[model samples]
Target chain A: MTINEIQDELIADFAFFDDWMAKYEYIIQLGKELPLIDAQYKKDEYLIKGCQSKVWLHADYRDGRVIFTADSDAIITKGLVGLMVRVLSNHSPQEIANSELYFVDQIGLKEHLSPTRANGLLSMIKQMKLYAITLQAKTT
Target chain B: MMEKTAVLEQFDVYGIRKDFPILTRTVNGKPLVYLDNGATTQKPLQVIDAIRHYYTELNSNVHRGVHHLSQLATDAFEVTRHQLKGFINAAHDHEIIITKGTTDSINLVASSFGSAFVKTGDEIIISAMEHHSNIVPWQLLCEDRGAVLRVVPINAAGELDMDAYRALLTDRTKLVAITYVSNSLGTVNPVREIIEAAHANGTPVLLDAAQAIQHIAIDVQALDVDFLAFSGHKMYGPTGVGVLYGKEKWLDAMPPYQGGGEMIKEVTFEKTTYNELPFKFEAGTPNIEAGISLAAAIGYIQDIGMDRIAAYEHGLLEYATARLLEIPGIRLIGTAANKSSVLSFLVDGAHPYDVGVILDKLGVAVRTGHHCTQPLMDWYGIPGTVRASIAMYNTREDIDTLAAGVQKAASMLV
Candidate 1:
C-alpha cells in the first residue's frame, strides 16, 4: 500500500477505539502481535539510540524497496515501532525518505505520546530515513 | 478517599504547603500531585525570596572584601555555613566545605583524599545501593591511582549485606564511601554499624546524605562519620549549593581539591601556599545567591521540626504502600524493613514509562527509569521502577490519587 493509504487505514483503525484506554489497549495488542526482529539484528550496531527503552531496528533493502524490522523491551515502544514498520516497510527507499508521515499528527498520537516518547518517535523516523538513504545510494 | 492518620493530622501540612508556590500549579488540567521528591523537592517561597533578597540587597563577594556590601554578603553567606553546621551537628563551622552539589562534593573528596591516602594497591569499599554520585567518584579515584574498588552487595530487599561489607573492610582499605539512604530504593543503610566496622580497620567513611539529610535528622558527631555530603535543593532549598562535612583533622590532612584565588594564602611565580580549614577548599567566588538561600532552606526545615516532618512522611509512606499493594498487579520494589518515605513499584502488565505517562495525565508526577542506579536495577533484574517519594507536605490524598491513577493506567495497558 501507499504510505498515505497505510496511514489512512491506521487512522481509521485507531478511530474505532472510543477512548485513550481503548487505543492503548489496541496498541498493546499490536505490540504482542508484532513480528519481532531476529536475535542477530538485535545487536548494539542495529540499536536506535536516544530511546529510554532499548529498541533495535534493522532494514533489508531488496528489489529497490526497504523492509524494516524492529523490537523494544517496552510494550508501548514496541507498539509504536509496529505502527512505524507497517507504514514505511515494503516501500521504495526514495519514497520512504520523502514520506511526510502526517498519520502521526492525524491520529493525534504525537499529542498523546509523552514528550520523551515523542522525541523517540522522531529519532526512530530519522534513523529509518538515514537507513533508506544509505541503501538508496547502493541502488544508484 | 484516604483517611489521614491522627499522627499525620498533627502536622500543619496545609500551612506547610502554602510556603511552596509551585504546589499551587496545575498539570494536565488536574491539581498537581508531586511525588518525585526523591529526584528533587519543589522550591519554597522562602528560598525563592532569599535568592531575590541576595541579588537585590546583598550582592557582593564573600570573605576577601573590606567594603560594606561585601561584609553584608559575607555575613549572610557565612550564616548558612553555621546553619549547616547545626543542621548536620558538625563540631565546628570549619568542618563544612561548600561545593556545587552532592556530585561535586564527592568528586572533591575522591580527588583530594585519593591523592593524600590511597595507594596503588589500596582498596576502597562502597555498597550496591549507592547512587551514581557515591559510586562513580570512588571508581574514578581507583582508576586514577591504580587502587582497587570493592563493592558491598545488597540483598533482594535492597538492604546492604552487613556481613559482606564487614568482609570487604580490611586494613588496606583507605575509604568506605556509601549512601546513608538509597535514592532509588529508599533503603536506609545501617550507617552507624558500618562506620564502626570501618573505623576498626582505620578506614575513614564518607556518607552520601543527599537523600537522607532532608528526611532524617543527622548528628555527625554522634554518628562519628569522618565525612558527610548533601545538597540544598533536595531539602526545599535553591540549587547549585551543597555541603561536605568532614572532621577537622581530615580536612587538615587532605590536599586541596582545586587551585584558585580564594583558596590560597599566598601565590607567586615561585610557589603557592594554601589557606586554612574551609577556606582552603572553597575555591572560587561560590554560588553567592545559592549560598545565602541555603540558610533559608535549613531554617524552614528547622522551624517545621525534623522529627514531626519525619513522622508525617512516615505515615504517608505507610499509607501509600498499603494503597499501592491493594491494586491487583502492583509489585513494589525495595521492601526494606526500615525504609524511608520512598515507594518504587511496577505494575505487572505495564511498563514503568507508560505508567508514568498515564499518571502525569492524572496530575501525579512520578520518577520512572533506572533513576541513575542502573546497577541496582541490574541487581533486581528489572529495567527500572516507578518511584513515588513523599515529603512532609504530601498528604494521604496524594497517594490515593497515585493508586487510583495506577489502577486506571493498568486497566488501560492490560
Candidate 2:
C-alpha cells in the first residue's frame, strides 16, 4: 500500500479502537502486513546495536529502489521496526536518505516511549538511514 | 493520604523524607507516588535549602578566593569532602574528588588508570550486571589500549557467579570494576569478597556504588575497595555532584584526568606541577553549591541513621515484592537472593511502556526501559521491564497503587 493509504487505514483503525489494547492489536496487525525480508538476509552485518530487542535489517537494491526487511525479538519493538520499514522501504536509497520522516509526531510514537526508548528509537532511525546512505553512495 | 503532621512521627525514621519538598508535590491531581528512586532519588529540603542559601548568601568561586564570600564558599565546599570521608569511612579526606556524577568518575579512572596500567593483552574484568556507565568506559578504554575486557557472568537468580569471576582472573588481570548493586536487577554484590579476590591477584578494584550508597550503609574501610564511585542524585542530594573515593596512594599515583586551572599547582611554558591528591583530579571550577548542599543532604541522612533507613526500605521492598508477585501474569525480572529496594517486572503480553503510561494515569511513577543496562535486557531476552525502586520515603500505599495499575494493565493486555 502507498504511504497515504497505509496512514489513512491506520487512522481509521485508530479511531475505531476506544481501548489501548485494541489499538495495540491493530498496530501489531499492521506490523504483520509489512513485507519482511527472507531468512537468508539475516546476517551479522544487519545487526543494530544499543537495542533491548535483537533487531536485524537487510536491504536490497531492486529496480533502482531499496527494498528493506527487518525483524526483532520483541513484538512491540518489531512492530515499530515494521512500521518504519513500511514508510522507508521500497523507495530509492536517495529518497530514503533525503526524506524527512517526522517520526515522533507522525505516528504518535514518542508519547508512548520513555525518554531512554525515545533516544533509542532516534539512534535506530539514524542507523537505518546511515545504512541507506551507504547504499546510496554505492549506487552512485 | 496521611497528613504531613501525622507522618512526622516516622521523622526519626530518618526524618530525611521531610527534607525533600518535591515529595510533597501532587501528580495527576493526586499525591505523587514516586517509586523510581533507583533511577534517581528526590532531593531533600535541606539539600535544596543549602543550594538556595549558598546562591543567595555565598555565591562565589571556591579554592582561590581571598575575599569573604569566596573564603566562605571554599570552606563550605571543602567541608563536604570531609563529610564524604567520614560518610564512607575513608582513611583520608583528600581521597574524595567531586565530579559531575558516577559516569564521569568511571571515565576518569578508565582514562587515567587504563592509560597508565592497562596494555595489550592485559585484561580488565567487569560484572555482567554493571550499568552502561561502568561498562562502556572500560570497553572504550580497552579498545583504545588493545586490552581485553572480560565479563563475569550472572546466574539465573541475578547474582554474580563468583566462580566465573575467579576463573576470569589471572596474572594478566590489571583491574576489576563491579557495581555494589545492580540498578536494573537490585542485586547486592559481595564487594568485600570480590575485592579480597582481586587483591589476592594484585589487581585493583573499582566499586560502582551508585545504586548502593542510598539504600545501604557504605563503609569503604570495611569493603576495602581500591576505588569507589557514586552519584549525589541517587542519594537525596542535588544532581551534577558526585563523589569518587580512591585510596590516597592510588589517587596520588594517577595522573590528572583533565588539564585545567584548579588541578595544577603551578603553570609553565612547557610543564606544570599538579596539585595534591583530590584537587589534582578535580579540574576547573566545581559545582560549588551542589557540593555544599550534598553535605547537608548527607547530614540529614546521618541524622536519620543509615541503619534505620535500610531497615525501613527493606520492609518496603519485601512488601512491594510480595504484593507485586500476587498479580497474575506479572513476572518479576530480577529475583536475586540478595537485593535492595528495586523491583523490576513485566506484565504478560504488555509492553513496559504501555504499563508505565497506565501507571502514570493512576498517579504512579515508575521507570520503564532498559534502565541503561541493555546487556541485562539482552540476557533476559525481553524488550524491557517496569522498575519500581522504593526509598525510605515510600510507604506501603505506593506499592498498592502500583499493584492496582499493573493488574489493570495486565487484564487489558491478556
Candidate 3:
C-alpha cells in the first residue's frame, strides 16, 4: 500500500478504538504486520545505537525512491518503525527527506511513550532520515 | 495479605502509609500499590504541610530581606541547610548547595570541575552500573575536553567489580564518579571502598547518592567523598529540591555553575566577583517552599530512624525476593550481595510492557523499561525488566499484592 493509503487506514483504525487499550492492541497488531528485513541486512552497518531494543534498519535507492526495511526486538517499537517505514518507504528520497512524519502527532504516539522510549523513537527516526539524506547526496 | 493487627503491631506500616495521600487513590478500580519508589517517592503529610506553611506564613526572598517576614523566611530557608548538614553528616552548613535535583547537581560538578581540573588526555573513571545521569555528564565533559572515560565493569551478580575499578584507576585518571546504589539492579556498591581506592590514586570522587540516601544512611565525612549528590523527592520530600555535599575546599576551588543573581557577590559592567562556598553554586531564586518541606521530610525520616527503616525494608526485600523466585520461568535481575529493596525481573515469554499492563489492571504499579540505564540494559541483552522497588512505607501486604498480580499476569501471558 502507498504511504497515504496506510496513513488513512491508520486514522480509520484509530477512530474505531474508543479506549487506550484498544489503540495499543491495534498498534501492536500493526507492528506484527510489518514486513521483516532480510536476515542478511541485520549487520553492524544497519544497527541503531543507544536503543535498549535491538533495532536494525537498511535503506537502498531504487528507481528514484528509497526502499527501507527495519525490525526490532520490541513489538511496539517495531510497530513504530513500521509506521515510519510505511510513511517513508516507496517515496522519492527528496520527498522522504522533506516531509515531517506528522502522523505520529496525529495519532498521539509520543504521549503514550515513556521519556526513554520517546527518545529512542526520536533517535531511530533521526538516524533513518540521516541515512536517506546520505543516499540523496550520493544520487546527486 | 498479612494479618492486619499483627502487621500493624509489628511495624507501624499502616500509620506510615497513611502519610502518603496518593496511596489511597484507586487506579483501574483498585487501590494504587505504587512500587516505583526508586524512580521518585511519594511525598508525606509532613512535607506537604511544611510547603503549605512556608508559602502561607513565611513568604519572602532569603538572605537579602530586612523586613520581619523576610527574617522569618530566611531563617526557615537556612534551617534546611543546617538540617541537611546533620542529615548527611557533612562537616559544615557551607558545604551543602541546594540544586534542582541529582541530575543538576552532577551536571554542576561536571561542568565546573571538568572545566577547571580536567585537561586533555586526563581520564575519568565511572562504573558500568551507573545511571544515565552519572554516565552522560561525564561523557559530555569528555567530549568537550580531550579526556577519556574508562568504565569499571560489573560482575555476573550485578555488583561493581572492585578489581576492575581498582585496575581502571591510573595516574592519568583525574575524576572517579560512582553511584552509591544501582537504580536498575538494586546493587548497593561498596562506595567507601571505591572512594578510598580512587583517593589512593590521587583522584577526586563524586558519589551519586540519589538512591542511597533513602535506603541507607550517608556520612559524607566518614565516606571521605569529595562530593555527593541526592534528590529530596527520592527521600520522601518534595520535588525540585536536592542537596549537593562537597568538601569546603573543593567547592571553594571550583567555579560557579550558573552565573546569576544569588551566586554573585558583586556584578559590574566589566567584571563580576562570585560568592563563597555554597552560594557560589546556587544561582537564581531557589525552590524555597520545596527546600523547607525537604527539611520536614528529613526530620520525619530521622524520627523513624534510618536504622529501623533499613531493617524493615530489608525484611520486605527478603520476603518479596523469595516469593518472586518461587514463580516459574522468572529471571531476577541484579542479584548483588548487598542490595536495596528493588526487585527487577522478567518472565520467560512475556514482554515487560505486557507484564506491566496486566499488573496495572490489577492495581500494582511497577516501572517497566530500561530504567534509564540503557547501557546496563544493553549489557544484560534484554529490552527491559519489570521493576518493583520498595520503600519505608511499603508493607508485606504490598508485596503479597504484587506477587498475586504478577502470578495472574504470568498465567495470562504464558
Candidate 4:
C-alpha cells in the first residue's frame, strides 16, 4: 500500500475508539507489537534525542526501497514510531522522501508533532524523511 | 506538627483557587488538574489586575523622564523593591537588583563577581541537583576566567552530600552557589547549614531561591547569605522580572553587569561613572509591569502568611506522597525525609513521557523530562521522571485526580 493509503487505514482504525484512553490503548498495543530495531543498531549513532524522550531509528536501502525500523524509550512514542514505520517503510526512497503523512492530525495526535512537544516524534519524522532523501541521493 | 495541621485546617484552599483564573479552565476536554507549579505558577487576580493597572494608569519609562507619569511609574517600581526587601527580610531596598528572571540574576552575579573576585586558580562550588540555570552560568564564568567548578554530590534520596560539600570548600573556593531547594527533587537543602559552612571558609554563598522563595520564607540577614536569586513568575507573579538580593558590600564591590542607560551615573567618551548598588546591576529599561505586579504576588502570599502556606503545602506533599505510593508499580525518585512541594516518580515498565501523555489526556498537567537537571537524572541512571510540583492553590482533590490518572497510565502502558 502507498503511504496515504496506510495512513487512511490507520485513521479508519483509530475512528473505532471514542475515548482518548481507548485510542492510547490501541497505540500502546501497537508499541508492544512494533518491529524493533536490531540491538546493534540501537546505539547512540542512530539515536535522535528529544528533551522528553529518546528515539533510535535505523534505515536500510534494499531493492531500490527504504526500509525503516525504530524504537523509543516511551511507549507512546514507540507506538507513533510503529505507525511511521508502517506508513513509510518498504517504499521507494524518492517516494518516501516526498510523502506527506497527515493521518497524525486527523487522529488527534498532532500535538506530538509540535516542536514545543519536545518528544522524539517530530524529530523522528524529520529523520525518516532525511534518511529517505539521503538514500534517494545515493541511489541517483 | 499539631500547629502545622491547624494551619492547614484553617487554610481556605477553595477561596484561594478562585483567585487564579487559569484554575477554572479545562485541558483536553477534562477539568485541568494543574500540578506543574515548579515550571511556572498560575497568577492570582491581584497580580493580573496589577499588570493591567500598570499599563492603563501608570505606563511610563521609569528613572528617565522628569514627568508626573515617570515619577509615578518610578515610585511604583521602586515600591516592589522595598516590598521584596521586606519579603525576604533583606537589609535595604537598594540590595534588590531587578533582572529578567532567575537565570539572568545568576548570570549577573557570575559575570560581575567573577570579574571582581575570581582569579585563575579560584574555585566555584555548586550542587549536583542544580538546574541548568545555576550550573551553566558558573561553567561559563569558570571557562572564561580559567577557574574551576566543583560539584557537591547527592545521595540516593536526592539530598545533598553535606560532608562532601564541606570537603569541597577550601581556600581556593571563592563562591558557593547552590539551590535553597532542588527544583527536580523537592529536597529542601540545609541552606542555613550550607551558608554557615561556606561562611566558615570566608567564601560568599549565592542561594538559588528560584524554587524556594514561594514555598519558604527567606531572611537573607538571618541566613547571612551573601546573595539570593529568584524569579517572579515562579511565585505567582508575572514573568520577565526577578530579584537578585545582594549584600550591600558585595553590590558595592562588584562591577556593573551591563553598561546601559540606568546603570550609569555619567557617560563620557573617555570614562563613565557607574550608578549606585541596585541601579549598577539593572542596566536597560526594566520590565516595569512585572516588577510592579510582583509586589501584588508578594501581597497575596503575605495575606495568606508564609508559615501558613508552608504548613498547608507540607500537608499536601505528605498526602500526595502517600496517595501516589498506593499505585502498584509506583517508584518515587525523590524520597528525602524533608521535602516540600515536589513529587518525582516513575512507573514500572512505563516511560515518563508515556505516563505524562496519558495523564495529560486525563487533564492532569505534570512535568515529564530531565527538568533541566540532567546530572540528577544521570545520578539515578534514568532518562527522566514525572514531576508534580504543588503550589498554594493545589488541593487534596488534585492529588486524588493525579493518583487516578497515574494508575490508569500504569494499567494502560505497563
Each candidate's fnat: 0.29, 0.12, 0.17, 0.96
lDDT of 4 by residue, B86-130 (tens): 999998999999999999999999999999999998999999999
Worst 10 residues of 3 chain B by lDDT: B1-10
Top of the candidates by TM-score: 4
Q: What TM-score, computed on C-alpha atoms, does each candidate reach?
A: 0.94, 0.82, 0.82, 0.98
Off by over 4 Å in 4: none
Q: What is the TM-score of chain B alone in each candidate?
A: 0.98, 0.96, 0.97, 0.99
lDDT of each: 0.88, 0.82, 0.85, 0.93
For candidate 3, give the lDDT of residue B204. Answer: 90
Interface RMSD of each: 1.9, 3.8, 3.6, 0.6
What is candidate 1's lDDT per residue for A1-140, written digit by digit as tens? 79989999999988888766677777778888886799899888987754357678889878778989988777777888899999999999888988888887877677534455532556777889998887778777
Q: What's the TM-score of candidate 2 when only chain A is evaluated?
A: 0.74
Predictions' DockQ, in order: 0.45, 0.20, 0.20, 0.92
Q: Model 2: per-residue lDDT, tens digit, B1-414?
A: 243433334545334456567877888676788998988888877787899999999999998979999999999998999999999999999999999999999999999888889899999999888899999999999899999999999988899999999999999999999999999999999888999999999999999999999888988889888899999998999999998999987887788999997899999989899998889999999988889899988997898888777877776788789999998888898898889989999988777865776677667899988888989888988778899998888877778988988997676444
Q: Where is the poorest 10-residue window by lDDT in model 1 chain B?
A: B1-10
lDDT by residue for model 3 over B1-414, one digit each (tens)? Answer: 445334345778888889989999999788889999998999898999999898899988887778998899888888999999999999999999999999999999999999989999999999888899999999999999989999999887899888988988999999999999889999999988988898899999999999999989888888899999999999999999998899998888899999988899999999999998788898998998988788999999999889778877887898899999988889999999998979999988777866776687778889988898988988998888999999999977889999888887677555
Query: Model 1: which docking level applies?
Result: acceptable
What is candidate 2's local distance difference test score?
Answer: 0.82
DockQ of 3: 0.20
User: Could you report the Cα RMSD, in angstroms, for every candidate shown?
Assistant: 2.7, 4.8, 4.8, 1.1
